[model samples]
Target chain A: MTASDDFAWEPLDDVDDLEVGDRRELSLASGKLVLVMRTETGLHASCADCPHQDTPLAEGMLDGSVLTCPLHFWQWDVTTGEPLGVAELPLEIFELKQEDGRWWIGMRR
Target chain B: MIEVTVEDRAGGRTRFAARPGERLLHAGLAAGLGLPYECATGTCGSCRATVTEGDVGSLWADAPGRRVCRRPGEILMCQSAAAGGALSLKLPTAFRDRREPECRSLSGRLSSFRRFTAEIGTFSVELDEPVEHLPGQFALISAPGVEGPRAYSMTGNPSTEPRLDFLARLSGPGKLTPRLFSNALEGREVEVFGPLGRAALRPEDDRPFVAIAGGSGVAGMLSIVEAALARGHFDRHPSRLVFGLRSMEGSYLLDRLSEFVRLSGGLFRTTVAFSDEAPDPEFEAIFPDLEFTTGYVHDVVRSGLSSISADRPICFVAGPPPMVDATMRMLVVEGKVSPAEIRFDRFG
Candidate 1:
């Protein structure tokens, strides 16, 4: 409602206690899994599955701003969704914002 | 025999012939096409390909790697056999050229067996034909009473004597290792298919390096260290190894690693990180050159990378999957090292 009809922001009420270097997977209304994490920089959102394979990114390791898949050690920049290390594909990213200390993630409606 | 054709990401194709029940992955690799694989024994799922034409049959229906083969036509190339007259598959890799000394199948004899701990042991495979493999490669060992082949990294390189050394941790009774450690079975014939794994140490990789290992995972790191010592590479660079064990009771390769530290003239150093117990004073006296610390391997490396002399040192890591993951995160995230500088193979 804050933006246009093409984009809708959903309240992520479960991530109230997420700390730096912590990641959690959230189930969307469309049955898609979204990965939410807090890095040293800020909170970021991406598809919970690695783009190389469907390995859950919530089980992966987050170092600073980089996210690494535990399966094959393929890495990506959490903020830019750009491929790093052995990854050949970019991660699917979503816009995450905070208001009044709470978080809301924007998805294509 | 039927034609087995493999297509890569760039649409380049390579063809080889395989028999009805032969693994097309082995055929492609033996034919000198760099078919991608890690543990060639139905694990890691790196050799997965889509069957675009003809057909293939699964040799192992319950392979754990099958988790990756979700599509109807997708198959694990290492666990599948040719079933039809002509077969075609597509790989996700851009055609990786086969490096020198492509793998082949051969028979070897067990010799020079010895035990370090009650559950851990080592021996040499005296091959009928000498296999020249790079440091850090592994081979699959299949003995008569064992269910299937188990992969073990080469702890030492092939010498003029035509022997390859390996270490094995016991998996309990009725397992492959109980026999491997219980006897000195020289001239015991066994099947070996390898020179597999991509963590091989290359002279061109880096002068300064850091090797971290846990438990029996030190075998591969030991091979790399020996190679560096043999080729005089240890003389020029300041490299370090931090090996993790539960306690001094689980330690192995003390003589060799300690000697490497002593001979390197301060260029190479080793730290034994004990997770379960504090550094023992008795061991401190025995290994004067080695530094002992009380911490996990990842945590130990984070606190101190002793003798590491370069900002961009190549890193070699091994152990269980969880250990490798934790260490990799620390290296790339906190240490600011690029992933391109790290080399390792995934294993169960």
Candidate 2:
């Protein structure tokens, strides 16, 4: 197995803490940053910064699964980091897993 | 109901459902057919096409694209829909992507609004997110409680973040600004779509630069000046900015412009021309280094360019349709500058 795959699932936070249509900012133990969001379906995580402007994505407005940048209003698919129409940059997404009723995000490093 | 036949450049014929009240560009864009357009409203003239058959009606009959219309049947597709049935149309087969920067809708709170003149106001929007845009770009702002979107140029420097500056003119009777003039509350949420415009400042060779502006036309010029200062263009090539206004009160961007002059350090010079009123003494005192003139902006630019003809300069004009048209005529026909070298954008 690869080193990225070898790391065991480490609990980050309780799923009940973040409500639907809300986002919480947190720093990982590995020093990598992530934005955890609770959508209608469940939980999703991505890089804190917007790929286009380096502004924090948590600062944007959330409409369901879409997050719109407040700076220039560029939007992205929060779950997959896929850019919407007229959005030039794609977001950075991370894998999320649930273990023992807690949520955790998979980090490459 | 007018039956207009839409045809591709390859002479393929397809019937499109068009109405007399709708515009041709709207119908074409809504039909999912890729048509060439920028500023899909009437101003850019990118949607111009030749009418192969039938009678059509154009709302703006005297559109400037009529100049490029050689045959009698040519019409602006954006301004005209279909007046009668069985209409035929043709478009260019291949289109080049002008690839203007991408734009999206952003929400902002009005940080401040101040009147600079009786007909103009300078306002800033503090966005929760900082939108990225190239210099000399514009945004479509939808004021809260307003029905439609209004396009305004970004006067703020691209290097700055968190807030954007816009100068809006109170022309005739409009929806948003009139409400704003009556005192719109600060911190109110406003929707904006933007960073739209192609009037970029690119300096070639070492020829002097000529910039002409009237009223809020300074938006694009401000972006150009910022770009120039960032690239040290003034140090390498001299620049002359000619600004025109109806009266002394109409000149609102003077302070910001004065800072540009200070940065250029004798390499850049600004000329202020007043049309309806004589040059104000206070303006002269404040802008001691600037040249003052009494006349229309286009005429002032004509005289300035005429005197500096030996310099072989490239001219840029931005303003209302009349000002842009008048200045283009003076530059191309009177000043003898090649049409390819002169550039202008009508903000109307």
Estimate every model's Cα lDDT from 0 to 1: 0.82, 0.71
Candidate 1 interface RMSD, angstroms, 1 decimal: 2.1
- Local accuracy of candidate 1 as per-residue lDDT tens digits, A1-103: 4464566878777887899989999987667689998988888899999755578988888888888887777889999899897786788899887889878
Question: What shift in Å separates residue A103 of candidate 1 from its native position after superposition?
Answer: 8.4
Stretch of 10 with least lDDT, candidate 2 chain B: B92-101
Candidate 1: lDDT over CA atoms?
A: 0.82
Fnat (0 to 1) per candidate: 0.43, 0.00
Per-residue C-alpha lDDT of model 2 across residues B45-70, encoded as one tens digit per residue:
55667788777777766655455455
DockQ value for model 2? 0.01
**Model 1, span B1-348: residue lDDT tens:** 999888987789879998898777777887888887877888678888999999888888888888988877988888899997888899876666566467788898898888889877888888888887888889888888676678888998545656789988876233567777778345688988888877778757656788999888899988888888887776777788999989887788878889989878868989999999998798888889888999899998988543232357788988877788888877766776767778876557
Q: Model 2, which residues run further than 4 Å from truth?
A: A1-109, B1-96, B203-207, B280-283, B306-310
Return the TM-scores of chain A for each candidate in numbered order.
0.88, 0.85
Q: Could you tell me how far off, in angstroms, the CA of residue B67 lies in candidate 1 after the best superposition? A: 2.5
**What are the per-model DockQ values?**
0.43, 0.01
> Considering every candidate listed, which one attains the maximal DockQ?
1
